[model samples]
Target: MRSTSSFFHFLIQKCNRKTRRKLKFSKELLVVDSTKIIVGIGQLPWAPLKGTRAGVKLNVAFHPSVGQPHRVIQSTGNHHDFRSSEELFDAAIINVADRAYAKCKRFDEYV
Candidate 1:
């Protein structure tokens, strides 16, 4: 099996290339969301108390046009979904996102 970093790198490159080539003007829509994974550090100095722990976030960019996920991205735990929107989809592409991504700047710039 390939290393985790290598696999993710390949995925990112493939997604970027695909998005650049075929993400043209269409009546399609894309959705984005993130999932969190917790990691235990065994009482590290910077660890959160009680319930919280170090974690990784999986930020996904899904094309709802086909009723299946098209592309996905994984980011650090602290990265917000909107902060990576531009990198997830091509510029000016139509995207359908939840209220968390309804910022005016992103809508004005990429919608």
Candidate 2:
């Protein structure tokens, strides 16, 4: 089994796709969202969420055109989407993001 930490990295390296050199982000959207799998608060105190809930966050960034998820970065429930994701901006392709990724400073740099 592959390590969870390097799972995404392994896919990018071995996935059957030319993500680079022909990335067309106009048809691709960097959809970002997190799902919570609530767990026992006392059992896994490390994964804290709203109120007394506790769980981990599954943060995903994908290219719909390529039919492959470019990134799947995980974080504790409390972590914000924008801060946890990579700087997903490319001059050659369009980068669409939601309100969570509305960082002016980062956007300026990306542009």
Candidate 3:
């Protein structure tokens, strides 16, 4: 398995380059969401909250036009979906998301 730091750095570099190349402003909208994955890293002493497991979160940003991902930000399972929205939106030319990401503040900011 790769170390956490190295994996994140690789992901950032890969995603940044791909985002710059693939994302185009053609009146196309993008979608943002997250998924949870179990990492099984054992228990930690300083956990964030109750009922949270040791896992990873996949924060995905994709354009609806071509159905391809533009940006992907990975974080701990405990990280909330909203926490990565700003970065995802900023990277996207147009942003679309599920009801789970329908926060008034984010919607207003995007507008």
Candidate 4:
């Protein structure tokens, strides 16, 4: 399992470097969204969503020009999507997200 994880980590780093090189001259734009993944309630007692279901959420920050996700954050399905925005957003880059992330305080802080 450790070897597999190492292999994937190296692969991802290689891909990210290549993508960065290709997009060096292009402007960076990040599109963010969250997707819920369902799991067995018995398998993961920690990720309870409702009475009978268990799941996890993946918050992804994607670089459309590079066709890859630059960042991913995982949380329990019950976690709010907007809460992950705080970690995904970079003050210098323009971030595009849906209404789920539209909190007035967060908007004002970015200004």
Candidate 2 TM-score, C-alpha based: 0.59
Spell out the clash pairs found in candidate 1.
none
Stretches off by above 4 angstroms in model 3 are 1-26, 43-52
**Two-way TM-score contest, 3 vs 4, winner:** 4
Model 3 TM-score, 2 decimals: 0.57
TM-score of 4: 0.71
Global lDDT scores for all candidate models: 0.60, 0.61, 0.65, 0.76
Lowest summed-lDDT stretch of 10 residues in model 1? 41-50
Lowest-sum lDDT 10-residue window in model 4: 8-17
Error of 3 at 11 (Å): 26
Q: Order the candidate numbers by lDDT, best to worst.
A: 4, 3, 2, 1
The C-alpha stretches of model 4 lying farther than 4 A from their native spots are 1-27
What is the alpha-carbon RMSD of candidate 4 to the true structure?
Answer: 8.5
What shift in Å separates residue 38 of candidate 1 from its native position after superposition?
Answer: 1.9
For model 2, residues 1-111, the per-residue Cα lDDT tens digits are 877437644544543346633563233344444555688788669887767779887766666557666667777877777776464443344455567766778768866
lDDT of 4 at 3: 81
lDDT of 3 by residue, 29-67 (tens): 566778777644455434333455567778898754454
Q: For candidate 3, give the lDDT of residue 90.
A: 53
Question: Each prediction's TM-score against the native?
Answer: 0.55, 0.59, 0.57, 0.71
Backbone clashes in each candidate structure, one number apiece?
Answer: 0, 0, 0, 0
lDDT at 96, model 3: 59
